[model samples]
Target chain A: MKNLLTSRWFGLFIPLIAIGFGFFAGALIMLISGNNPVTGYVALVEGVFGDLYYFGETLQQMIPLIFSGIAVAFAFRTGLLNIGVEGQLIVGWFAAVIVGISIEAPLMIHLPLAILGGAIAGALWGFVPGLLKARLQVHEVIVTIMMNYIAMHVANALIRAYFQESGQRTAFIHDSASLASEFLAEITNFSRLHWGFFLAVLACVLMWFLLWKTKLGFELRSVGHNRQASAYAGMNVNTNIIMSMSISGGFAGVGGAMLGLGTFEYAEILSSFTDYGFDGIAVALLGASNAIGIFFSSFLFGGLQQGANNMQGQANVAPELADIIIALIIFFVASSYLIRWIYSRLQSKKEGK
Target chain B: MADILQILYTIVPAALIASTPLLLTALGGLFSERSGVVNIGLEGLMVMGAFSGIVGTLFFESIGFGFASPWMGMLAAIILGAVFSLFHAVASITLKADQIVSGVALNFLALGLSVFIVREVFDRGQTDAISARLFRIDVPFLSEIPVIGPMFFSRIYATTFLAFIVVAIVWYVIFKTPFGLRLRSVGEHPMAADTMGIKVTRMRYIGVMLSGALGGLGGAIFAITTAGNFSAGTIVGQGFMALAALIFGKWHPVGAMGAAVFFGFAQALSISAQQIPGLAEIPQVYMLILPYVLTILALAGFVGKAEPPKALNQTD
Candidate 1:
């Protein structure tokens, strides 16, 4: 019974059940608010999958989420919680936009350079907290939270000073630096579905391979699992910590580049957090901090966010319901031990019968 | 020199008003962290309190309890805050979930739920301004004191006095009481506390609830004083600032209060920077980012390593 409950497939079942409960709680909230749950859900489903345009929108939403989720999952595997993904992502977005606008090169060189600029900026952002934690044992949670605000302000100030074009946002990037694809746009009925979607998928695959197939991945995971033990086993814990955070930040940086070079092709002044970073934390948690799991969960979150507009317009359900449901889902996932206990108890009962 | 004093007079009152909320919320954080459960959801809890406080005030006023509305609003905030915090308590203590994740989830839930309710009930993105706000009060004899009176007592919100009184009570409860010992022990060494018949889970639960109540009061005070209405941006990052103050104070009630005042002074400076002589040259964005940068420096142990509760973030 224990073995069966501990099986790999059973791990997926816990999140599935949590998702179900989350939906149930959301439906109850709707009912209490005097809205019809069935109509609301139908609108939600149709919003994400009704037509090619809707499906494309959902895919567009999924791109950044997938990158951020992978970023967070990667850091978690190294036993570090990268709450600073938001800061890294914002810095990355600014770096990509700056590079995209400044340099005028051929498409082949310019696109990659812009993306790499973002990745490097994000890596630097992640490196600060990583260095602090490694040397001083300073907690990353508060530091990252602080860095997020600083990053937002810094990004805003830089855009206002250098990149502003008489609007709240910067000038559009050069066409050669953009990730938008004409063919993909035509196929999706002119939705903003771009080449970044393909990049997101590639990132997931890369994360899986890097974590499971490489010696450094093993060292990173070992350090995450047991820092003292890893140190005794001759691993340079500080270097690995910095490397893990840098790599994780790189993923988020690319995710941020998707926003700059794909969806918007410009950077806007942000008065508050973009919320993608926070959403990434939820996605990583729901995905159990695994690459493939992150991909699927990102799609789920993307669908809900995409559908929320329709739900609010047609069913008279507030768009905030999606946020509430997502929060509940994370809450349930955090309580997975209870789910495991219930699953094991039911398994034992079935065997006894 | 006279101009400087005039600026200080305006800034000091603003600082007192600002610090009141932080002082209340940081005290709440101290309680939860002392019991070994890191409640990063203080921001969310504060949001809930602010929303509900306004709602309660409006509801009571509509029913013709105009004079009693604000106090009633505070009471409702405390009840709702305690209820909302149960999710954190269950997730962290009973289910043994990751405390940070649970706290973050609570923040999301609070923001989403409050916004949803506001749209439904008020048909707007934010709640209507409450008619009966907690007004500034003048102390009888204290207000007559020459320099000290105007800066400290006159034209201050009752919540500011309430905050100081709460701090003294919190200090007494946390230091001089038997319950405080058990709560501290549970945080430091839960296994040892458990073996000593102290009931670590129960102590932790009580600590979290106390935090919720105080956090709720802080939110109520913020709503009544600064915001005047509940909007999505009303609690913008203050809860986080309070968390920073909690760390800056090194997790003590009096220390937390002192840190809260320091943060409040920073906030006050940012608001009135143009009036100040030297700070007028810097961009507002730089001033806005100052508190957050200071928070990071504080956490980096520039003031000294702020030791957290030993069993903090550890699952049972």
Candidate 2:
């Protein structure tokens, strides 16, 4: 009984239970709203898997979520919460668009350069708060929150000044700079699914390798686990903090680049936040802050997002109902102690039997 | 000189109006933080408060409580705000969840639940504008004063005055009362407080509830005075700005009020920038970004060391 309780699998079990509870609560909410929970859930499932186009849309949604999830999970492993992923993502999208327009080259050079530019911009944005926290002991949460607004306004101004194509959005990037793959599109019935999906998968693998195999990753995790002990053991805490944040920001930057280059092929001015960064927090928590876990969690969240429109249309459930369910999932996951307590009681009952 | 006075006339009253919500919310944050429980969900709480306030007012007006509907709305907001905040308190205090994550979760829940209810009830994303907005009134004796009267007393919201009064009350409660001492002790050193027979959990709960009450009132004021209706964007980033004010003010009620006023001045300037000579040349986006930049700089210890409550995010 004790072994089962202490096993590594228990960590995975708690989140599953939390998700189960979340869905149950969602069902209750639906019932109270005078809707059939079964019908709504079925409609949601069909929306994600009804046709090739729906599947493509789901995959497309998963791409940025995967990137953002990895970004958040990496930061968590390094003992940081990168709430400014939204800011980094916005800056990255802008940088990718800037590079896409300014540099006239073949796809071989232009696309990679645009993507790299985005990563670099996001890295720079992440570096500022990381540097401040490491050097001056300033709290990262408030700084990151402030940075999100600053990034939004700056991005808006930049789009208005340099990239305005008539309305709030910029002109589409040249073909060479685009990540839109015709082959993938044709297979998916012309959905927005693009090469960025491959990039997202690659990022997850890279995250795993970097965190588990690399010496720097070891140092970063040590610093995150015990800053005082790590510092005493000769790890450069400041450097690792900056490195973790920069890399985390780079991941979100890639997500933003995927949005601009693959999905929309242009940067649009936003009056409010895109919310992917905030959603990344929930994903990282549910995924348990691991590469494989984040990938799966992102897929789930992505499916929920894609399925929400269908649920609203077919079942008369508000799209925001999905958000409420996601929030409840997070709430349940946050209260892991409750899950642990419940598991212990069940285990004791089985032992007595 | 005349132009400067003219700008002041336009900016000062606007600044006071803007500062009211920030001051109220910051005071709410002050209470929660003082009890060692950080409430980043102030934003979410404000949203709930604003939504409930408008909805309550609309309902009361429909039922024929014409002149008293706004007060009833504020009352509803306070009750709902406190109830909603209990989720954060339970998650953070009882469940021993990471306070920041729980707070963030509360934010998502508040926004989602409020929007969902709005759609379910109104069949739209927003409610109709409430007709029972809180009106501004001039103070009897104070309005007769010279230039200062118009600037500070004339045509100001009663809620603004209420916010200032609450600031004083909070200051007195936090610094001068035995209950305040116990609350501070639990926040700073829960184990020590426990050893001394102070109920740490109870103190923290009260502190969190106090924040909820003030936050709800702040949201109601924002809805009644500024938004006049409940919408997703009504609360906007005012709750966050109030948080900044909490930090900038060094966690003291009077200090937070001062900080809120400073931010309010910045916000007011942003709104009226195009009307001001020479300020018209600069882009409005820069003005919008200024307060956030200032907040970041303040937090970075450029202005001064903004020390937070000890053991603020620690789990018992």
Candidate 3:
């Protein structure tokens, strides 16, 4: 039992079962709604795998999910709950667009700069909450919630003030700042695949490498495990908290850049949230907060996002069904204590047998 | 002088009306937090309440209970909201999941489920605006006061008065009653409370359920009085704002009420500022962000370190 508790495969196994339960619940929902669960699921699968175009769209969705998932997971690693990822992503999106619009440089210089610009903006957005939590012992949850609103309104205002185009969005980003690749696009049959895919995969690798292969990561995880113990052990808990938050925000910001430079090519004013940052929470939880786990979980979230649209189109299912499935997955994953308990019961039963 | 008086009348009543929902929801938060559970699912509960409130009203009206439909709807919302909150309770309290994660899941579930039901029933995104909505009533004796009457006492929804009454009742119950003491003790130190023979788990459950009821009432009041309908967007960040109020008020009932009113006043000023001479010059974004910024500042110890109950978020 103890060995199973410590096994890494056990971690992966739990999430797989949670995902299975999520699909099972989704099927029940489909049946209850007078829609055939099989048809609904079939439509969901075909939506993502049917064509190169749909596959490309799923990748486009997955890129942001990956970055945002990292944003949430990185913070979770350092004993911080970054509910402000949406806000950070918003600021990063705008900052990236601002850089893309203003900077006239070579592709080598401009694209990375725009992406960096986004990271900085997101970091700044996250810094305030991190500072408050570190300094005043204020709950980060409330501060992050407030920050999300501040980001939305401030970003909208900035968009309207300086970058108001004829329509709702900013002017198209410069060609040099674009993440689009003609090669990827042509291969995907004119789908919105771009260089953001590479960046997202790199982000996953970066997170894995930074956390598993560094001393700072060790210190951060130590703090997460026990802040008092870490402080007694000569770790600067406050600094670690702030650093984790800023890095998390930077990851989320890159997600914003993916949308601004790769998918949309312009920044639009938002009344509602982008949903990527929020969904990242679901992804992070579903992934068990591991880099590889985040990669796969993001694929699930991303596939659902694109597939649900097709389900709505072809099978007449609401795309919100995707959200419902994700929510159920989180719930199932969250209640793994029950799973563990059930496992224990089964173990006892086998012994009795 | 007359212009100032007129402005006060419009803004103060508007502020009170707006504060009603926050006041009710924050009180609910107060119960849950004071009992050691951080009800981040306040937002989701309100969404469930909002959906049910409108649906209940429509059902009541269809059954020929025309004038009483809104009240019935409010009752229905409270019941449904409390039941919906069981998901959170089971996840956090029973299953011992991460409270924050569970809450976030509930928020997503609420929105998704509500919209799914809407699509199923109306074949559209929003329900029809119910005819029998709650109305503002003039306090016959109080409205006749020279200056303060029109601003504070006149033309308010009955729900607003009920909310204030609820605040007083909650204050009394929390500060005076043995049950409230047990709940607070459980939140403060579950082991200690358990040692003292207090049913910590039971108190926490009651606390969470009460929050759900109040949160549901808040949602129903907003829908039946202000929104007059329900939809996907019905309860957008109000739950979080109410949570802020609960924190800013430092887990005290009256304090939370004051914080809620303060928040509402800021909101009212922002909305009514376009008519005010000097304030109209401020950017809309600044106006919109004002309440949130103030909440952040208050939480940053500017309000002198609003300490939460010690065992908040711990599932004992």
DockQ values per model: 0.82, 0.82, 0.80
Per-model TM-score on C-alpha atoms:
0.97, 0.98, 0.98
Per-residue lDDT for A113-206 in model 2, tens only? 9999999988888999899989998888888889988999999998988789968999888999999999999999999999999999999999
Docking class of 3: medium
Off by over 4 Å in 2: A349-353
DockQ of 2: 0.82
- Residue B22 alpha-carbon offset, candidate 1, angstroms: 1.7
For residue B233, give model 2's deviation from the true position in Å: 2.3
lDDT accuracy of residue B189 in candidate 3: 92
Q: Worst 10-residue stretch by lDDT in candidate 2 chain B?
A: B1-10
What tens-digit string does per-residue lDDT give for candidate 3 at A133-222?
888788788899899999998999999998989688899999999999999999998999999999999999999888889999898889
Error of 2 at A270 (Å): 1.3
Off by over 4 Å in 1: A351-353
lDDT of 2 at A125: 87
Q: What is the TM-score of chain B alone in each candidate?
A: 0.97, 0.97, 0.98
State which docking tier applies to candidate 2: high
Q: Report every candidate's CA lDDT.
A: 0.91, 0.89, 0.90
